[model samples]
Target: MLGTIIVGVILVIIVALIVRSMVHDKKNGKSFTCGGDCGKCKGHCH
Candidate 1:
């Protein structure tokens, strides 16, 4: 139906935006897996 198509399109757009943001962060040297606590990170971010 029209509603289903609209929902699917919206979901795809949302996923695309998320991926774009992740890529931007990666390009800026951001770590998605790092907890931000270097002491506890145990050199994982290194």
Candidate 2:
């Protein structure tokens, strides 16, 4: 019904946001946990 459509749209938006964020982080050379730099390692060590 209408409610289901709304929920689907919201989920899609949320997923799109998450994907955008992940892509942005990747372009900036960052990891989810290491925050772009793994101190103990060398260059671009994500």
Candidate 3:
């Protein structure tokens, strides 16, 4: 019984970690820096 609870907790934690890293946090990183608009800038300030 106790072991089953521990295993369930571990599985939940593993799933949480997997879900956490599976997607990108759009706000935390740079936006679309693709060279689609190079016509406006001499060179990217990147």
- C-alpha lDDT values of all predictions: 0.79, 0.83, 0.59
lDDT by residue for model 3 (1-46), tens: 9999999999999999865654343344422453335445544624
Better of 2 and 3 by lDDT: 2
Worst 10 residues of 1 by lDDT: 30-39
RMSD of candidate 2 to the truth, in angstroms, is: 3.2
| Clash tally, candidates in order | 0, 0, 0
* lDDT, residue 46, model 1: 56
lDDT of 1 by residue, 4-43 (tens): 9999999999999999988887787766676344567676
lDDT of 1 at 13: 100
Which prediction has more favorable lDDT, 1 or 2? 2
Window of ten residues with lowest summed lDDT in model 3: 23-32
Which is superior by lDDT, 1 or 3? 1
lDDT of 3: 0.59
Please provide TM-scores, in order, for all candidate models, with all chains considered together: 0.75, 0.73, 0.50
Residue 30 of model 2, lDDT score: 85
